[model samples]
Target: MKKNQSIYLFVVLLSGIVFTACNKLIGIGAPKNQLVTESVFKDTISIEAAVLGMYSKLANYNPGTDVGTATSLFNGLSADEGYYFPGTFYDDFKNNALTPTLYYIDGYWSNLYNVVYTANSIMEGAGAAALPEGYKNRVMAEAKFVRAVCYFYLVNEYGEVPLVLTTSVSESNVQPRDNVGKVYDQIEKDLTEAQAMLPSDLRYYGGNRTRATTWAAGALLARVYLFRGKWSQAGAAASTVIGNPGLFSMQPDAAKVFLANSQEGIMQFVNAIPSSWMATNLGASAAAVTPNFVLSDSLYAAFETGDARKANWVGIKVYGGKNYPYPAKYRYINGVGAVEHAQLLRMAEQYLIRAEARTQLGQFTDAAADLDVVRKRAGLGNTTANDKPTLIAAIEHECRTEFFCEWGHRWLDLKRWPGIANPAVTRADEVLGKEKGTLWQSTDMLYPVPQPARNVNVNLTQNAGYTN
Candidate 1:
């Protein structure tokens, strides 16, 4: 009964529990025979496995079912980015008529919390383990980064969510929703600590870009600050990553940006299989076949004439004599030797974040310079925007074209940006109202908290416009 051998045994048992629990919501009671975290974190190998498990769970994409695809798919449909053709379960999202009882809504909430709970377990276990200090800190930092990302999405999609920081089910089950500002504060705190604790070298994970680094933390932090309207802080955070030319640079070729381990990637998830889930779902291998998702006419028209991204990143399928454009970012629909990986964070986003932050701070010239870097890569000339208002509009347009159907960037942006007539109204209200024609409501900006989640925990409240 050696210590390392016992810990190894615990890791094996824990794997089963984690895999099983990942499929359901956290509000359900903990399964019987779960091993204690303290026992599992006794050794270095087990601790590494625990951290690796977090990525594994998040990266496990099951076509259209899991959280990995939910953001891009559901959010794309909800916003002006794309349309869902199947008219099945996802129609609710496409029409901005999401209900609390939808299975995908429940699945998304539960899956994200599953990752958060795993991160909490790792941080709690690694803190008290008799491991080396540096190694322990790195592991905990990684967990914090993962947790911060999960919470970021949760807050954006659900408005206010229970800030679950502990692995204890009893504590999580009865927890009430925290305010959006408070949840964002926690995200900022986690990412700030992660930036300090993570390694500066991107090659820490053997040059794979699959693991989190200081640059990844900074990239995400910059985005957080931009969303919060902390313009100066956002610019500074984005500059940290953008300034490091050796570690990161924009891929000159727009087509290669989503390739596995590209120079542009700050953080990506290595697909368990050789192909990407996005490719299988969005990309139709043959022109004769129709894509499940197609770009909206507005998004297709947003591209400037002769923009390379429109040519390279968008695929046109000619079916029934009508052209349908779908996302061609991943390109490989089937597993054919690992050509693409799921990208989480990349250098292009940092540039856009800085561009927006600088525009907000009235540094219009510098902001245009940042915006042009992306535009130039897309084979378009520098932006014609010269003032604050124009620069803001230009930056938003660039983000929409560059990140459409990737990670719900367009959906979230529409919600955050202010409407033209009234600062109190969001762009989502103005834009979606015209597009949806009476289906769009301001309260629909945040999705309903899944009814299943509220059923399990009476403390949970539904978002406005959706009945409990």
Candidate 2:
């Protein structure tokens, strides 16, 4: 479907960098499906086509195509795969370096910026042209939201990037990275604008989670604040959305949030296979993923009996005398062509954040209520926070279980907080030995901008830790 009017039109117009410049945009002359820039404002259909193309970009930005899906891949890492997913043969990611072949990183970075360009074309064209007022505003709002999201992804991945705001691509297009601080500033600018311009409802977002709206913007702002350590702002942003009546509530059954036509999903980039970007050699591809990746024995054993979430994983049918279990998150796709919609967010995370914010505010009892709401859904009994440490532990435990398979939220949670490291290392010593995955130092953050891109973009510099 069209992302918006102008973007879909531009997508129909521009496929890659050849037309990044605003001049080249209208310069190429309009395609048969489009109205030329000089006259598109009079044609709503052409405008509609351009906007739809922006949404299609998300569905089309594939890691397999050497476009970035790093966000997709990173968000998919589980507590178990943090140990296995990064290496040649299942090694801890921190102790080793990631290779340039990590196409997801490259692709995601490229795709996000491409989104920036597509979005800019829509924004600039509409602003400079004479599209219908209603159609122009709607399409521009969608474009801004997507552009805001692109910046968020970039800032999260590479602390800084060239902040290009025009559809005009030129030899001058080569831009150096902005400091992380400046990037965050640009992100806030876009999100604030996006929040104002986007509609209040979910339908306007259009694509899975690809679209951003008022609440999504709020939620993302909360996340940004949290990451930047703006606790009060984070609390305020999260609370606004968390307390928005009739807006969001936990899934009636979190277990069924993934059914083919599931309603609970905020967004996912899933599509029917053989459609495009299928990992080749299907069965063997499936097997390769399983052998190297499975629930860590520690996490597997962590599941309490009667926990319905445990059922999501595919337990080994039989292996010699032992039985093994692998997460079946993607398993039920069943058919080779079945499109398993990827889940990005649901009601579950908001509860965890409210619980966390409450805990951080020292409202232990309230925090406990927040935690219990989620804990109750996962088949875990309600938790009581008898003391400070107890409340924190309870919150951590709730998150581990709540976000188990969707993404490696657990690993990132550990990475965020400080002074909690060594003790956690001691805790994981049994499964991971002396070197637990620790965010012991600041330098450890923001993965090295992979070498391949570094070597080529002379204006680009690597993050502090990596070398070409």
Candidate 3:
């Protein structure tokens, strides 16, 4: 019943009947007890609650769960974004000591799969459910959006993974890992279908930004295509999101982006619960009690003297006789006044994606304009990157500084950037430095498939360079 653990801990499953009694815990709609799969989706409200429940699961990042601190904290530690105090339980990540049997590895893997299960459960009931045409399409689209996002993270983190798109236990159990390309293909198909069904006007349930919309679909597609090196598709998808100026626009103040219901949020998870893991780990609220992480020396030094991001977003505190910089993006830990919503997607990233995509397409002049939108927002001048190569490098640098500890954007970018054909594209290795005869290994690029998963499912294979 703890807030930090996955909602799966409270999920009750009986004879293909699934429901959660911990609905009060995460403040999402609860399923009727022992409700059959077909009956559960009969009502429009129930279907909407199911999608909201996925967001509740995604927000549980206090101590465990990969979607929360696992990505925001550990990813920052593993990448060049920040530093974690060595010798804690997190040392394995900061020290680059990842292995199949690592303590929290399976927690992340299970967390994501549990979400996929919920999405699949919703999708399976779509046809049988009694609902209006528009309502049914919206429900199915939102389910696919959540499912596709989870699968995207799964493929990027674990490389290849089982693609379970159904609720049939017999089918899901014996499946082997699919190739990354196949996984990406499924993600594209799901997102594309979802985009068509999503509400273009953002008529989200309860007038909350937490629910997925057409803009969310577009932003996710842009990110997916940009990572896959599909330039035209990436640019067009980003433009689709950016083109909707009424629903989306950059917050003129960089500090306002993380605020709940800020203008910059394209898709966000409402923290109905009082506690915020992002605030607890990064901001000034929990520093005096349990300050576990701080920004790395290199990251703090990456910002220019006049950069407003460094002045406003990055913060410093003296802990244990050493000066440590902590992330002040959230600035609020407890849910008292002005609750913090977990920012899943925002306007800033779409701009960066477009900039990178445009640079890749040899539109250097246009790329510089997009890059400046972010730079000027940070109280800086236009980029010096005039040519394609320099423009691409500038865009990459903007992504690193603009999005440091939000999601695993930096980590994902590091893995994807190496494959860019542009010689000027800054390689991840050139940026990720080594320490004491140890550098990030080729295998380190992808996480090991959790050992516990392989233990039960013999078909599941670990990624290269990790033992089963």
Candidate 4:
């Protein structure tokens, strides 16, 4: 048989396996069947298809269970950014009383691992294939970038997690949880390698912001470094992206930032369907109807009086003689008028990351300069903060107002920042305790490791607050 014919046969068999195994392996099984053999990677088209499939899964815009949507929704609720009014299972998150048995928790855990397993599969197949070295490098780099993103969220949400880097079911099924520091080490390694291999041209994705590039890797690395408290590295990484003005620049108009292929978007997910899940859920389709998910009073109040983001990114619906403010970042609820894409990384965030890193390093003047860039875009004046302590507080406030109800940035920030009055406690502890009254607990900082995941793998352990 010719090599091409044999490869075609393998593709046919793999398609069958994918459909049959997706359901069985979706949750704790990690979609082991989606792992393609090396023969499937022999051709460039097949290799591209494999990588595109991973993006499709990550970009799944379904309202429930998808990792991207769940991350924004549940985490928004878990923090003080929003409220869920239907009295559904999501209320647990709003109350900071998540359980291992919670439906969305299990869905989130399963979907995230699904992405990880797909990335591992791509790396293994690409490594073994007889493709050109450059092509193979690009494929492997993209896979590593995807895996790093999933692990970033996993470590943040679940604390210790099984660092499953291979597609072998036997290896993954019984893997034990690795510590937070170890997981972060792997994430940094993956991103560093990806940054070196990815194309620097923004148009490498054919003038679309959907795919990963050198800028995407650098932007994410800046965020990862900031979270890890590596001040200089974070600042440097962010500066690399900010310096590339031709490829990326902040949208002067806050309302235009979420539009498809906006100049501000470092990386985004082009909607698979015409509509966006964020818009459908957070935006009111009709004037009389209220969105079930509304922004919290505290978040609405966080915006300064003259901030452009408050005027442009928030939509208020008056129904039954009451006002409900919801996220207007994505305005196309049904995809009828203007197009919107799910923004994963943007230039504004890079400026904020650099500002925070600069503040922590005691470069107050430079940090304030970065902060003012975002402030000026929001139609606000330059920051009054001149010293390290005040600059840090100012940067934190900007992050809250700029990123609220977008991707759980507020939730993550609250957990990471020191309390205003007491440095000993996290801002989450101090803030949520006051916001949620008696409902908040310190252990709620990390969500429970989903019970179904624990059921399938005996080696998996529960987090501090949750019982079996």
Candidate 5:
């Protein structure tokens, strides 16, 4: 495993910072002209420079953005789509510590904040510069987009976190913890604002994949609202994208879906192409720990023999005499070498969110329609059971079976939705699967904030059940 040996990585959990306790507490709600003099950059052209800063943050933290390693822990932990990563270990993660390694909770923590800080700086700096009228607003919108994404990731990983909107270098950065609800609320607002500002005209011609777009902002808002149980908002946001949704769809073949050169991908980590990657499960050239990324038997059986998704998604191989169904769809980033880019938000998740949201809002028919769209793409015929309970079952089933082994959505999804109320688990009988080794998935949804971070940052507090 390539360690985050980069000097820039200083905190954890938030992705960019790696230091323990007494973290760099710069503060939030920064005014525009503090670090930046309003007169230096006085034109619209320079504003693009600031926006470039926003772009820089993503390029800085993403592994594909790295020089060598292309392992995808951030994507893996996102759930459902990925399997275990080797070589990397956090004490809290391994032992399921209520209070785990804050730094190692995930690099996304530091990586995200690093990006957020850069965004905040650019937004504030460019605004103060007053380069052009709409330029600052659009740039700030991009900052908000970055902020929303950071907070969204935080919410999914840990229930609640501090809402540090300003760069830590600012005096106001010392804001208290916002409840998970409020954090999400802010995320919604940020994305809403960003969606209005982002342009729909941009597209990547080369290997660039991380730039923000209206679809990304809109899709993220939908995901956040669905996560928070705001069904109507979720539906509205989802409709915006689904209304003119991208040409994304399942590869009639599941195996082709994970291939490096897949066409159906909506948003993926763009790597220098023609070459792909596969990080070692045990940090070896061969995936020792990942072990062919076997599909859960239950998930495999859910597909029919004729399902295009099944034939394309899973490969039945005997690794040392044990028959394992490996997810062949991720050949771009999962075998033999480093696939620099990791696909983050894909359109299929949107359909699940829409289907799940519709069910929560009691729009079963609409929900079933959304569910069927995904199912048909996966080559699964519509279910015979037309009832709400049965339809929900099928939807959740599709989510699990169709989306297995991309990253680690399965584990996190269980955390986010442990109870029946979660749209994914509408049926009384349906139970989403669990991790093979840990109850870490059950009692605690997130690994506790690392002990080191709390020791130094006096303002920072520990989670409810952790040992600080």
Candidate 6:
């Protein structure tokens, strides 16, 4: 990655040392002059520069920027998705000794909110910028979409969190954790507005698929609704994106979905530089023979004997006279030529979301059809799940295989299933019991609020299980 260039571009957006615990204690905020100064807002080019700065911050594959990197690795180790062979970086997650002081966990919390701060800066400044009407509206919409996505991951990971919507110094440091339901309400509001303002087609800047569009916003809304149990809304959103064949389609080959500019990419993190951490850390390549993570026995055994995904998505190697299977979805481990881009939001997930939503709404037969789209693509025949109860189980199985090791999809699925009301039969409770011989506690679902955040703001309470 062009670390120096990216850091220089985003330094203005950062305003202060990242939203760090130390910074908050010192009462530091972006100085008024450093924010979108009147001179900067008066020019359209400068305004665009500021917004692109937020994109640069996200695309940087540093400690906390790439959610699919360290964050997903830790989550997969904690769940049944995979096994980490690296150092004690993963021990806290794997062995359930997670404390608030874990550096990576703390970095994830602060880095995400740093992105949130940039988004809020744009939202606060764009309204007064002297730009063309169309340009101003599009910039505002993109910022809102970015902010909503950040909060989506935060709420899912840390149940209740501080909802920082403004860029004010005092408000940023003093805000108390909002209820999870309340946080989702704000996410819904932002995405709904973004859907109307962004363009219907895929957006491009300098010939790269980095900007958000209305379709991207819709696909994400579908996922958010699915998580929140809004069945009809989720189904409708997914169906709308599915209908847009010009903008999206399922890649007939499951192996090609992670390739750059693939047809199935609804939204992706365009890699302008060579930094495919997914491949380097998870696969065996000439650049590195021993990968950091290996596929879990349970995950490998779950595949059907002739499943195409098993053949195409995993690579087997012998190290120290033991077989190690690693994720091969990302083929460019060396990151030379930047052949692979990070797959964040894609079309396949929309189908699974719709299938689950339709099942909840009692549209059993239609739900089966949506499941078949993904199933057939994976070299499997139509499912035989004829009833709602049976079909829900079938859909869950498809998600586990389709999205394993890509993001934290499997871990999040285990948390969302069985719903909050049915804690006794939670999927984690059952699966963890068999895999690790231990019972899953309810609080294990959420990561503890990082101690640094709590140290800065006394009102922030840690999640149920951990001590600050």
- Give me candidate 3's TM-score against the actual structure: 0.89
Taking the tens digit of each residue's C-alpha lDDT, what string does model 2 give over 313-432? 334433356654555555433355335555555566766676677667777787788777777777778776756678767776777766654444654565465434455442323223
Stretches > 4 Å off in candidate 2: 1-42, 63-69, 72-95, 99-104, 171-173, 202-210, 244-247, 260-263, 268-292, 313-322, 332-340, 386-388, 405-408, 421-444
- Please, what is the whole-model Cα lDDT of each candidate in the order they appear? 0.84, 0.55, 0.73, 0.82, 0.55, 0.75
- Best candidate (score: lDDT): 1
Error of model 1, residue 447, in angstroms: 1.0
**Candidate 4 at 366: error in angstroms?**
1.0
Q: After superposition, how far is residue 377 of candidate 2 from its true place, in Å?
A: 1.2
Clashing pairs in 4: none
Model 2's alpha-carbon lDDT is 0.55
Candidate 1, number of clashes: 0
Mind giving the per-residue lDDT tens digits that candidate 3 earns over 93-159? 7766688887678777777776777777777776578789888888889889998888988898889
Which candidate number maximizes TM-score? 1
- Supply the global lDDT for candidate 6: 0.75
Clashing pairs in 1: none
**Per-candidate clash tally:** 0, 25, 0, 0, 56, 0
Preferred candidate (lDDT higher): 1 or 2: 1
Question: If both were scored by lDDT, which would come out higher, candidate 4 or candidate 6?
Answer: 4
TM-score of each: 0.94, 0.76, 0.89, 0.93, 0.75, 0.91
Worst 10 residues of 6 by lDDT: 19-28
Candidate 2's displacement at residue 192, Å, is 2.1
Sorted by TM-score (best first), the order is 1, 4, 6, 3, 2, 5
Alpha-carbon runs more than 4 Å astray in model 5: 1-56, 59-95, 170-174, 203-210, 245-264, 272-302, 315-317, 333-341, 421-442
